[model samples]
Target chain A: MATDRIRDFIRTTRPDGPCLVVDLDVVRDNYRAFERALPDSRIFYAVKANPAPEVLKLLADMGSNFDTASVREIELAMEAGADATRISYGNTIKKERDIARAHALGVSLFAVDSHEEVEKIARAAPGARVFCRVLTSGEGAEWPLSRKFGCVPQMAVDVLVYAHQLGLTSYGVSFHVGSQMTNLDAWDAAIADSKYVFDKLARQGIVLEMVNMGGGFPTRYLKDVPSAEAYGQAIKGALIDHFGNQLPETIIEPGRGMVGNAGAIKAEVVLVSRKSDLGENRWVYLDIGKFGGLAETMDEAIRYPITTDRDADEMEPCIIAGPTCDSADVLYENTPYPLPISLTIGDEVLIGGTGAYTTTYASVAFNGFEPLRSYVI
Target chain B: MATDRIRDFIRTTRPDGPCLVVDLDVVRDNYRAFERALPDSRIFYAVKANPAPEVLKLLADMGSNFDTASVREIELAMEAGADATRISYGNTIKKERDIARAHALGVSLFAVDSHEEVEKIARAAPGARVFCRVLTSGEGAEWPLSRKFGCVPQMAVDVLVYAHQLGLTSYGVSFHVGSQMTNLDAWDAAIADSKYVFDKLARQGIVLEMVNMGGGFPTRYLKDVPSAEAYGQAIKGALIDHFGNQLPETIIEPGRGMVGNAGAIKAEVVLVSRKSDLGENRWVYLDIGKFGGLAETMDEAIRYPITTDRDADEMEPCIIAGPTCDSADVLYENTPYPLPISLTIGDEVLIGGTGAYTTTYASVAFNGFEPLRSYVI
Candidate 1:
């Protein structure tokens, strides 16, 4: 939903072209909610989610740590008032020079899922704290991250062992249940895997000190989603069920959940028509589409709730697409989107739950259209 | 293959990050080949494929008309020395204001697929030359365009009639066989459909003049594609078969065909490792991925041939991915790519057939990485 402030801003300013307006108050509230829900766990706001300087500064001022994927993100976080100690170089796949750059910037924590990555970290950032990411089934994720990222628990054990031998601190283990995960129980198995690594590493006299529970928290889109409290309580119960009394230092990286709902995209309907006279569905073209920022629409994985000024009118299913020359720019075609039948050209539409993973996914200038403009309030 | 010029540029400059190098000589040769292929047809270089200023300038200097998607593209073409009369606003979807802007900028040709779009063009750019896009099955395409673009032939006739009623010039019919199309006979049915539209319009005394055959030309990847001359011969035969002796003016919008083989991307291997001790495939992470550019890798639809310095070494299949934290960054996994067994971190890999659709698809700043840098030699 577009916050009252965001709605007023759009109504008054009427920024030209497709633009995203993020309400900082909502981001502040989300940060507070996450902090309260996981009081025992440190919050590492995933910097890649928004990376807006204002959002970062707000979170940093509120004492939030950051999980960055690259040296540039580290610089952004630092620029927003975060210390190196509060930042983690969280991508498992990294170049050796980047690792060295992060190390020089005083970022001591790093993520590694393979021996090769560990070798690079060992050489570039000797003695840095390293975490091995264990693989998850990603069964209940709306956006299931397949086998591209983490390794199996057995391999993670080997990787951590290798890190320990290289004089690096085998400080922890990490696993992402997957992005936009819905099932609350998704963390149970992953927590169990973390425990297994912890026990195995302890036996080898290389005790793991933390479990970085990577982000997968869901944000409300077209469907209702559980609150941060629900996720935190579920994750805490799982950690207790698996590790008993002594819980390792926990870190939760919340990207989508932190900012997805804080932003709303204001776009205009460019065209509305059926493919043929007898066509069943109306094809609605918006100024923004896949290349414009809503790339999560790929495979129709993330269904954004679209609201138009004519929503009070009778509704019909429509094939939604972007205003680009590419055929792949269609957003909701397989499962047509339910939009107001009265919607026509020049009508304004608000796409909700686009605060995260939007501006960055936008192309630089595909079809000569500029990148999705963003305004942080 | 990376052209001699591109290879020499990369070898001499040794750009620090992943970058695309395009050879103007290759582009010039491609333009000549297309002209030779269909002597009767006019070449409309699809600017969306590669809007590099140097590229546009080169095509403009060679008397190539431009197929533009937005007003910015029109301005780009004009800046490259293409007169407004030589550019076509080729995207069927458009904003009314944008149509007005294009008209004010002296653009007179427009594309429309539905009555609603025709109405906008008529109201915004009165008496503009409009072409109705007829639907194609998009079969025999490596990257199928699906039903997001055109209208059915019967509906196209209605659309053109409606355009004529609205005081717009119903100039012709257009269709895209699909991107990276390989089937030589793919243009036959589409051309036949155009003839049907032309005949229907002529019966009503609204004489259509041209047939805009939208781009779908293939580029050589791992497998060899038919030559431009071969495609030209096939298309010409299809046109003659459908139109008989009195053929209308024809426009060929060749995006990928004109530029895909003219450029190459130079990237470094960031990491190479197997997931587990018993893992069968090595995961090769490069400095660039889908978001950085090469978004055509979505669904592994377009596979660019990858070459390494150690190609003479033993070869094995590997799962290729980008260096981003996102799992969707994996380029090739379902069908593993065969690469040199000796390939490891720090090794340079050149991705060929990437001249088109690379720099433009790159994210503005996903994961804090810069967009794919382009160097036009």
Candidate 2:
């Protein structure tokens, strides 16, 4: 579906270099998949994944809730016609000014993991609805959401209790199993931790009535990532399995899975050559790289399955790189990716499943190269 | 030096969030330092290192030649008042349209490695001055130039010959020792390889007239990186050692080395907390992170020495991180960094020696956060 869309876009647009091609059709399908699997849950579509105006407008028109992280994202969501009440500020780290601004903009819901952050929110946005994050091991995540966020069960309980004391609305508990998570058990484990934090708060007579299942939903890439239905079913089962009939008003933050397959990048192969005479290793350079919208390729963490117009039975292993002069512009070096030996300069390279992070992560003209241009269909 | 400048800027400007403060006076001083050190060499200030307008204007006003990688850079250099002849299209992997557009804009110098790129140059901008890159081991460089660009010595010879055959001006051979190069031997070795390529070109009836000693000059950070004078002396010696009295017109593309020390970033600590009860390891979350602008800290490679308003004799080991929700936002995790235990949320943390790659590497509103605002004084 993406190939046909990309082909049609290329035939019409004919981009000279790298271009992001976003199809709203695939996005609508992905949203339906999530809805069908978790009919009981609310979708707080993570705005950070792909904050394209068209994508937001499509989701907002469907009355989807949004997971906003900053004041700007809150504004973007609002501008896209989503009600402020339908947006939740999910980032634990917030500036006081942003907190005040978001609250003034009517974003009453927030997420917190630290005592200092909770205090800031209380000072800046008093009476805002808040959620506590319990730490997850973040194992089996392509990009582990580890160490950067969340707290222990005791601390999570304390954060909620402190929120209640500060006259803030203690709403729920949240956790990110991590981005591109494959193992459903990781969510099972995180839910178990969230239950501990939730039960502890319930005992203290604080009935936090929301359960935020943070974003980590995977989209199809190089591997057979679990379908959105599979993830939604697993999460729903865990919520019931862990909490029984006491399941709180549920929210699922879907970023990557919601939009990853909906977009693709059409990049031109700038150069292709054999690096060493001794080894059979071939190096293929594209106009897009780490600083040029492919920052997700750091250490080959997020592999965007690549294909070219040129096909050959005799494929050669190659390392993919960006056009920047920096040595760190390499996209893939460790992975043994085989490309058609017939691939040559000026050939089109289509990187699939790049809709979510690719355009958003582009560097601001690292080498005088322009930011990635996206064409939404 | 940067602390005082930043404090003065913030006092006067009153920036609400992360600010990139670049002292043009310091940039001028750094430029003068390079000019004084490498008096015999032309300084093609690599624009990628810091594409700030003020930085470009200051360098251009001082009559410094620029090393531009793309058509946009060429326009920026020209807009900043640098003569077209002074700006070389140094990126080897360029689209033909960019080449044609840059040529129409009066740029003549271009760098090429592969045959296809050479052909594109020939077709788009015939008679453009060209340089071929010979592969370097990229040893003794912090970021290791590795296998991204450049070709073998044999390919270099063939490329130069091919450029000449295509009626393009085969000017010389170029090679990068890699970014932030510490070992002088890498340059010496690269110079030797350049000589091999140069000599091979000369024997083929083409007298190449330029040698570009590509950027890699180190800047002072956590450790005592060699001074600009030290690098200039070693490079001067190596150029002579390899080319002797017959040395061609030389160019040094000093990017980070020229502008790295001239800028500093004022970031606020969003949160600081211990990860778990068992481990005493603290994490200091800053408003800026890898996506926000400090992308050079790939795997703890480029370390920026940090200082805070709050200082104490009592310190704790900590991992620095950016405010983004991505787990990959962690900046430093490998090395032992001791931070003041008294440091808390809302404290201003100044990251020093960030002038070069900071602003240029920031993602374009990643997570709905604004680009790093730069104020050149």
Candidate 3:
């Protein structure tokens, strides 16, 4: 629905180049929807998603906590006038210096998935709250990040236990099913896996006080997906089934699911033509591409819902490419995302569901194309 | 080697964080090597490869022409003191306004892969020197970019003829085998492909003046690639075989090959530990990742040779990861890259062979981690 306004906005404004437009009204609505869906859980907005100044300020004013990944993020959150206590250093892989800097800045909460990080945190900020992350299968998520992060149940238990021994506060267990989690029950396996860690720690007389249901909330895209409310019910069912009557202080960190629907990008079709006589579709080249902002195409893993001036007309499968010198900059080659054959140069393509993981994720100066221009309304 | 100066400089300067140290001396040597190899071709350094001020300044001083992709890059090259006339707006896909602006800025050369672009260039920069790009198989390249660019023989010929009909100057034909291309003979197929376009265009009464050998020049990385001179000799042989001494002015546009080995990066290992008992390799987490920098490790497509303080001793297979919250930040998951087990927190891991695509290809503000800092020596 927001895309309608955004499309018309682009048509009327006619922004000369590719621009990421933010409707603050849509962001507020998404936040309210999430708040209504998960009333009891503390919401920590992942700062990695759309770290625009205005977006941060809006969320902070609305009293949303921040899940920061690095020292710079922690500083940015604080600079946005967010209370230091509202920020958590959420990346498990962290530098010792960043950990120390966060500690010196009065930040207490941190995420750790390994013994090495546990030791680093202990030396940097003893008695700080540290959550151990559990690895999931990362199945059914558009952007599965299973390989880079998380630990097994036994490893998570060991990491938390070791953190306790080293005089750091073992906060709880956290698990991310992966970004853009489509299968609502994807968290079921990880939630059930966390029980092992909780039971083992309780046996050791270290009572866990919290459980972090990490972010994987899917955003609306071209493909069919479960609603956010359905995601809430599925997660609620998992938490209830696992924790039962012993549910701790629950927290949820949402990155894409929060801001994705709030933003839209308008990219002018720089050129449109049939690549070759054998090729059936036209090559639709846009100003914003893999390097120029829209990097989350992730090889079509998370397809962004696209709209154009000729949407009502007949559509043809076109090879969508970014305007870059790199051949790898093709946004969707095999992904049969159809566009209007009538789509021509100077025609604007409004990319919906780009509120998160767009501008901030682009190369600073790839191909000399300017990083995506951002606007907040 | 520039890495040697960078290493000593790091040891002396003691940079506090991840830094891309570029050696201008190495760049000069690389330029001279290419100059010696392709004596007939004008060397247009692909600005997108590094685009560092000092690097551009050095190349410009050595009379290297610049292949610019965007208006910003053209401005950067000019600001770096490169003569504007020596710069070519080489990307086939460009906005009409940008095309006009480049013409306004005194750039007359452009690349075209389709009739649509030819029309745009004709409208924006009438009579500009234009080159038509021919498609290749992209075989034998460490980083293949075949899908996003290039047109087939028929389309390339059509484009050039169309440009001629539209009263614009059709400069020549261009073809890219791929980036970090191995097989020195890979250019042979494309050279043959260009002959058809050349013969067809000549039949249409359009005389071509040049043939651009688009950059795929390999840099020294983990795998051994052909020397720039070898690539030149192979290309020269192919041109002579096909053209039979009727060869026109040849042009070479080198991005990675020119600056890839001229730079190195130093990133501290944030943590080192086993991902899990099931996963065999220890996870070597660096402060930099796909976002912080080092994005060329595309599923181990272009593996950069690595070095560390404990390089001489026993080594074990390790999964290299960036210190980011995104799971996709893992550099080499299944590559079985080995590092000394003694590598621990705070150990500096020098990622050699990273000069070409590291800093210029990272997410600008991902995970709130800072962009890769660059130092020119």
State each candidate's clash count: 0, 0, 0
In model 1, which residue pairs have backbone atoms overlapping below 3 Å? none
TM-score of 3: 0.97
Per-residue accuracy of model 3 over A1-377 as CA lDDT, tens digit each: 35566666776887777889888888787788778888888899898997888888998999899999888888888888898899999988887878899999999999998998999999988889999988888888788875667788898888899999999888899988888888877888888888888899999988888888889887888777687788779878988999898877888998888889889888788888776888677788888888878888767777788887699999888888888888888888886679987787888778888989998888888887767888887
Order by TM-score, highest first: 1, 3, 2
Per-model root-mean-square deviation over C-alphas: 0.9, 2.0, 1.7
Question: Where does model 3 exceed 4 Å of error?
Answer: A1-13, B277-279
Q: Report every candidate's CA lDDT.
A: 0.94, 0.85, 0.85
Ranking, DockQ, top scorer first: 1, 3, 2
Task: Output the lDDT of residue B99, model 2.
Answer: 90
Error of 3 at A283 (Å): 0.3
lDDT of 3: 0.85
Q: Which tens-of-lDDT digit does each residue in A1-377 have in candidate 1?
A: 99989999999998999999999999999999999999999999999999999999999999999999999999999999999999999999898999999999999999999988898999999999999999999999999998988899988999999999999999999999999999999999999999999999889998899999999999999898999999989999999999999899999999999999999999999988888878579999999999999999999999998998888899999999999999999999999889998898889999999999999999999999999999999
Encode model 3's per-residue lDDT on B272-363: one tens digit a residue. Answer: 88767776778888888787777777667877778887988899888888888888888888777888877878888788877888878977
Residue-level lDDT tens digits of model 2 in A1-377? 25587779888879766889999988898889889988888999999998999999999998799998788889999999998899999998888888999989888999898777888899999889999887888889898775778888788888889889998989999888888899977788888888887889889999988878888889888889777778877887888899998988888899998999888888888777665455657788888988878878777888788877666457877888888877778887898688898888778888889899888798877887778989888
Better of 1 and 2 by TM-score: 1
* Worst window of 10 by summed lDDT in candidate 1 chain A: A271-280
Residue B224 lDDT in candidate 2: 88
